[model samples]
Target: MTIGFSSRTSRVARVAVCCSAVCTLAALAVATNPEGAGLPFGTGAQDAKAGQEPPSLYRPGTQARPRAGAPRVPRDVSAVSWLVADAGTGEVLAAHNAHRKLPPASTLKALFALTVLPGLPAGLRHTVERAELAGVGAGSSLVGVKENRTYRVADLWRGVFLSSGNDAVRVLAALNGGWRATAEQMQDKARSLGARDTRVVSPDGYDAPGQVSSAYDLAVFGRAGLRNAEFAAYCSTATAKFPAGGWSYDIQNTNRLLTGAGVDRYPGLIGIKNGYTSKAGNTLIAAAKRGGRTLVVTVMRPRTGGGLAVYEEARSLLDWGFRAAGRVDAVGSLVPPRPAAAPQTGPESPPVLEEKEEVTGPGWPAAGVITGAAGLGAAAVALALRLKSGRLVRD
Candidate 1:
């Protein structure tokens, strides 16, 4: 005797079964390798020592790992290391091999700007001497500022951001009392910002033997640089005139995200920086604002055989970050500076918010989700399960 229900009932049963199967597989997958399930931040064993792995933002005794219900993390990004973070809160939303050190190219200029912009008066004008222009690396991008021409600090900044000008960096570094001092200051600033992986051997971010930075550090620089009005203005300026003896040259921003004239132009795109060299591949630190939220994305060493893959990858991470903003838990937070010690002889001061570092294991599993593209496949399975569960209940 055939024991079959009506067609509608049969269809519902099939869907319910399919959904259950999908959900079971997804659950099994997550159980077997929770680290590989596309959760943004780490929810793994903590190492005793700091710096072993990227720290987690989720506090102890909380649900620190990414859940199956979390938004599907993007997996098509091709950078060797990348990170996306909430610009205001310093929360690291997603990362892939974020601490892996590599050549930063011109993206390090953001750090240069952060370190030096605070010291130079915006209106300070200095005549460019031949000596100031010397030692610019061969084939470095330039803004064509001729020697013996006076440029305001603001204009030199424009040259720096608009053209990724190594010459501008040199000029500014000289003004700051030579490249060595500037480099030392930049490295100090990086350390203060919790960017431990950065070592600034060149003020202009040239390909030096030990000039290295990580995606995490670049994001740190981007966030810090954007806090300065002048830095923000310089990076956002799409075009400006650079004065030379009698003729002025119009320089345009090298960051295509802000200009909207490239392979992709993002709305609310602001100033940051981009870089490429034979050794560094392609690097970008991008920022954008939407609905009162600002996001910074850093991509490094993206496969660059063709079109603006760096920009495209940056845009993708930005889109994903916006979509995932409030949906996923922060895997980590950018460590804030330690509060200044109170003066020993001063009046009682307000309590300062103490910063703590959350440690993760040597094999930080959260990286597995961010770095491995296969996490999205598990997300697909989880989605199928959710759909099936809903349909079954309706039936």
Candidate 2:
């Protein structure tokens, strides 16, 4: 079939370019990645035997699909593992060691929030219980949930998003039943979302023995969360008030790209979440909108620079994804497979594309490409469309 992509959105098509570093197992297995966590994928005979192969470009020591005229994936990307993808279509523009699992730190909260946000009403009120906060891990970030205090569920969510608070996650997990139960629910939620790389050990994303998530899974959580109205509201919220006894204090979101708290303000930025630990270093999920397109990026455990590299790398990736839009094809897809009759844990779980209704719009992106304009201005996109004829996309 023949399809015409809008010069604006076409720019997003197949924008993925070559990765500077084809991260190998030896290069990735740094001290920060404990217990051979950075091992490259698709190395052994086992990988060849396994029926469920990830997109070729995403395996260990691999680069994203390369296009003739496309720009290179930013070499300055310092994270050990990272991915850039279209949020709406779940089309992965670029990835490097995308499935390498490592400690997620607080960024795992996005999964926790996604697991619970749908079932709970934002307006529901609950009083804090001391027992609920008891299991919070040491050195964990806190949003200061006070005992015997009544708070709207919205406020608690703010605590979770804005402060990355374990205390608030504890209370909400308590409300959800218990933290242990919530962790199990989160695991199920990850499976349903096709985030096969994540293992939920704590709903709060605290460092734990078995807790780990991949760049691909974190991007999955960010993209899925952006689809929900409540999730969108909470994550995008820059600052909010929380009760402290009779008074309240303000807490700003730690997402540097959102509030520009420690870094320069990112244009068209939509908040997602950020995380850190002595072990995890700095892991972040950031989404930005521009020219009718939204892109999400995940960076896990930068090796050289400290926490700042996480935000800077995300910014660099956002810039690349926007510019590369319509210039390349997706190396692999982030879309979860459709329901199939097969074992969930086995090596045969391959990708199954979701069924779509039909395309009726004048300038719709092709079958696999998803595009939409956001609240941000589209003047640049408008000009780009005016300068060039629409790109032809054949499916």
For this target, which candidate reaches the highest lDDT against the unseen true structure? Answer: 2
Clashing pairs in 1: 57-332
RMSD of 2: 20.8
The residue-by-residue lDDT of candidate 2 on 351-376, one tens digit each, is 44345623222212233112222211
Instruction: Give per-residue lDDT, candidate 1, residue 263.
Output: 65
- What is the C-alpha local distance difference test score of candidate 1? 0.78
- In candidate 1, position 114 carries an lDDT of 91
Best by TM-score: 2
Backbone atom clashes (below 3 Å) for every candidate: 1, 12
